[model samples]
Target: MKIICTKSNLAKGVSIVSKAVPSKTTMPILECILIDATTDVIKLTANDMELGIETRIEGEIIDRGIIALNAKIFSEIVRKLPDNEIVIETDMNNQTMITCEKAKFNIAAQSGEDFSYLPVIEKEDNIAVSEFTLKEVIRQTIFSIADNDTNKMMTGELFEIDENVLKVVSLDGHRISIRKIELSDSYGQRKVIVPGKTLQEISKIIGGEAEASVEISFTKNHIVFEFDQTLVVSRLIEGDYFKIDQMLSSDYETKVRINKRELLDCIDRATLLIKEGEKKPIIINIGDESMKLQIKSQIGSMDEEILITKEGKDLLIGFNPKFLIDALRVIDDEEVDLYFMNAKAPCFIKDEQQSYIYLILPVNFNAVA
Candidate 1:
C-alpha cells in the first residue's frame, strides 16, 4: 500500500488507532496496526481483542493495497517526522518504507490478512449524544470506576437510557457516582455496561467542542462509538450492574450546605497529615453554624472549621478523605448539599437538581485511632 499525507494527519491517525494496540501479546499480530489504502481514503485499524479502533485520514492513495506494521515503531516514526508531507509505501517483499523531508526508514511488514478486524455492530439499537455532554458525564464518573478488575461490573460504567434522559453510573466499593443529562431527542430505552477503558479512550479522542456529537450503537455483547471520522468497538462486560438506587436514601438526620471549594480544600489539607498506606478517616463534626474537620495520623493531626448552613439534626461522621475529595472535585457548582442519615450510614453529596449524586460510605469512628 502507498499513501501520501501530511505528517500531522498521519500522526493523529496513528495516535487514535494505537490506543488498541497491545503493548505485549502472545499473538504478535495484535501488536501491529493494519493500514488499508485500497480506496482514496487511508484507513488504519488496531485491535487487542477486547477493544478495537479504526479511523480514516485524508490522503492520496497511490497504490491500492494493505499492510500491517508494528504500531509502536510506526507511531514513533510518524510522530518524530518533520512537519512535511509523508509518503508510506509497501513493497512486494513485505517491507514498508516511511519517508519525510529528510528522514527515511524501512521496516518489515506483516500480512494484513492476519490482522483482526473490528466487529460490525448493528445500528438497530443506538443513541446519539453530544460529544461535549458525553465527555462531561464520563469525566464526572470515570474516577469512581474500580481500578482492579476483580469485580468486572464495577470496573465499568453503566449507561442507562430512559426516554430522553441519559444516566451514567460508576462506582468502586467505597463510592458511587451518577450523572444525569437530558438528550435533545428521545432514543428509546436501553442499558449497557461500558468498560472504563473504552470510555476513557473515547474521551481522549473526542474534542471538548459542544457542537459535534457521537453516535453510539450496541449489540448483544459489544458497543460501538462513532465520532469524528473514527470508530471504536469494544466488548461489554457481561452480567448486570449493581442496583445502586437502593443504596441512595433521602432519609438523612443531618443536611449541610457548604461551599464545594471550601470542603474540598479542607479534606485535601487533612490528607496531608496522613502517611502513605494509612487509612485514616477524616472526622467531621457538623453543628448548627459550622462544620469541623479533624485528621489524626502518625505524622500529625489537623483541625479546620468551615461555616455551613445546616438543617435537621447535628451529627458527627468519619470518612476516607479521598472519597470526599473525589466527589467534591467533580462538582461544578459553587455550593453543594450533603446528606447523612447517621454516623454509620453513607454520606450523600449532590446538587439541587439531582443531576449528579455521589454516595460515599463513612468509615467507623473508631477506625481512626
Candidate 2:
C-alpha cells in the first residue's frame, strides 16, 4: 500500500484510531492497525474486540492495496514527523518505508488478511443530535456509572430513544442520575445501552462544536456513531436494564427547595471532617425554613446552614457525603428540589424546573422497626 498525506491530518487520524488498539493482547495480529488505501481515501481501523474506531483521511493514494503495521511504532513515527507531506510505501517483502523531508524509517509490515474482521454497520436507523447538546448530556451522566465489575448491565449508561426525547440514566445502586433533552425532530423509536467508555470518547471527539451534527444508530450488538470523517462502533451491553419507574418512590411527604451551589458546598465541607473508613455520614436536618448539614468525626466536625423552603414537619436523615456531592456536581440548574418519604425511605432529588429526577438510597440510622 502507498499513500501521501499532510502531517497534521495523518497525525489526527492515527491518534483517534490508536485509542482502540490494545496495548497487549494474547493474539499477535491484534496489535497491528489495518490500513486500506484507495485512490481517493485512506482508511485506518483498530479494534480490541470490545470497541473499535475507523477513520478516513483525505489523501492521495498512489496504489490500491492493504497493509497492517504495528500501531505503536507507526503512530509514534507519524506524530514526530515534520509538518510536511509524508509518503509511506510497502515493499514486496512486507516492509513499510516512511519518508519525510530529511529522514527515512523502515519497519516490517504484515498483510491485512491476518487482522480480524471489524463489525459492519448494517442498518442506518439514524437520529440527529447537535454536537454541543449530546456532548453535554454525556458529560452530565457518565461520571456516575459504576466502576466495579459487579452487575454488568449497571456498569454502563442506559440510553432510551422514543419519539422526541433522549434520556440518559446511570446508577451504582446507591445514587442514580437521570437526564432528558427534547429532540429537534421526531426520529421514531429506538433503545440501546452504550458502554461508558464509548460515550466518554465520543463526547471528546465531538470537540464541543455546536454547529456539528452526529448521526446515531444501532444494530443488534453494536452502535454506530458517525461524525466528521470519524466513526465509532461500540459493543452494546445487551440485557434488560433495571426499570427506574418502580425503583423510585412516588409518595412524598416533605419538599425542600435550596440553591444548588449552596447544597453542594455544604456536603463537600461536611466530608472534610469525616475520615476515611469512618461511619460518620452527613446528617441532614430539614425544617420549614432552613436546612442543616452536619458531620461529627472523632477529631473534628462541620456545621452548615442553608436557607430553604420546606412544606412539612421537620425530619432528619443520614446520607453518604461523597455520593451527595457527586450527584450535585452534575446538575446544571441553579436550584434543586428535595423529596422525602420519611427518614428511612430513599430520598429523591430534582432540579427546580423538575425536568430531571435523581434518587439516592439513604442510609438507615434508626433501629429496625
Candidate 3:
C-alpha cells in the first residue's frame, strides 16, 4: 500500500486507532495497525479481539493496496517525524518504508488479509448524544468501576436506554454511581454492559464538544460508537447486570445539606493522616447545625467541622474517605444533599431530581474507632 498524507493527519489517525492495540497478544497481527488504501480515503484499523477501532484520514492513495505495520513503531515514527508530508509504501515482501522531509525508516510489515477487522454491527437500536455529555458521564462514573476481574459485571457499566433517557450505572462493591441523561430524540429500549476499557478509550478520543455528537448503536453482543471520522466497536460483557434497584433505597432517617466543596475538602484533608492501604474510616457526626468529621490513623489524626442544614434526625456514620472523595470530585453541584438511614445502611448523595445518585456503604463505627 502507498499513501501520501500530512504528518498531522497521519499522526492523529494512528493515535486514535492505537488505543485498541493489545499490549500483550499471542497473535502477532493483533499488534499491528492495518493501513488500507483501496478506498478513496486512507483507513487505519487496529483490533485486539475485544475492542476494535477504525479511522479515516484524508490522503492521496498512490497504490490501491493494504498492509499491516507495527503500531508502536509506526506511531513513534510518525510522532517524531518533521512537520511535513509523510509517504508510506509497502513492497511485495511486506517491507514498509516511511519517509518524511529528511528522515526515512524501513520496517517489516504483515499482510493485511490476515488482520482481524471490526465486526459488522446492526444500526437499528441507536441513539445520538453530544460528545460533551457522553464524556462527562464516563468521567463521573468510570472511577467506581471495579479494577479487578473477580466480578466481571462490576468491571463494566450498565448502559440502559428507555425512551429518551440514558442511564449509566457503575459500581465496585463499595460504592455505586448512577448518571441519567436526556437525549434529544427517543429510540427503542436497549440494555447492554459496555466494558470499562472501551468507554475510557472513547472518552479520551472524544473532544467533548457540546455541538459535536456521537452515534451509538447496540446489538446483542456488540456496541458501536461513531463520531467524527472515527468508529469504535467493542464486545459487550455477557450475562445480566446486577439488579441495582434492590440495593438502592429511598428511605432515610436523617438528611443534611452541606456545601459540596467544604465536605470534599474535609474528607481530602482527613485522607492525609491515613496511610496508603490503611482501612481507616472517616467518622462523621451530624448534629442540628453542623457536621464534624474525624479520622484517627497510625500517622496522626484530623478533626474538622462544617456547618450544614439538617432535617429529620441526627445521625453518626463512618465511611472510607476515598469513596466519598471519588463521588464528590465529579459532582458539579455547589451544594449536595446527604441522606442516611441510621448508621449501618448506605448513605446517598443526590439531587432532588435524581439526575445523579451516589451510594456509599458505611463501615462499622466500632471497627474504625
Residue pairs clashing, model 2: none
Model 1 RMSD, rounded to 1 decimal: 1.0
In model 1, the Cα lDDT at residue 304 comes to: 95
- Using alpha carbons, what is the TM-score of model 1? 0.98
Residues 113-150, candidate 2: write the lDDT tens digits: 78875787797577878888889888777777898878
Report the alpha-carbon TM-score of model 2 versus the true structure.
0.92
Q: Which candidate number would show the highest lDDT if scored against the true structure?
A: 3
| lDDT agreement with native, every candidate | 0.91, 0.83, 0.94
> For model 1, what is the C-alpha lDDT against the true structure?
0.91
Tens digit per residue, CA lDDT, model 3, 1-369: 788999999999999999999999999999999999887889999999999999999999999899999999999999999999999998999999999987999999999999998897776678899999999999999999999999999999999998899999999999999999999988778889999999999999999999999999888899999999999999999999999999888998999999999999999989998878879999999999999999998888889999999999988889999999999999999999999998989999999999999999999969666
RMSD of 2: 2.6
- Model 2: weakest 10-residue lDDT segment is 360-369
RMSD of each: 1.0, 2.6, 0.9
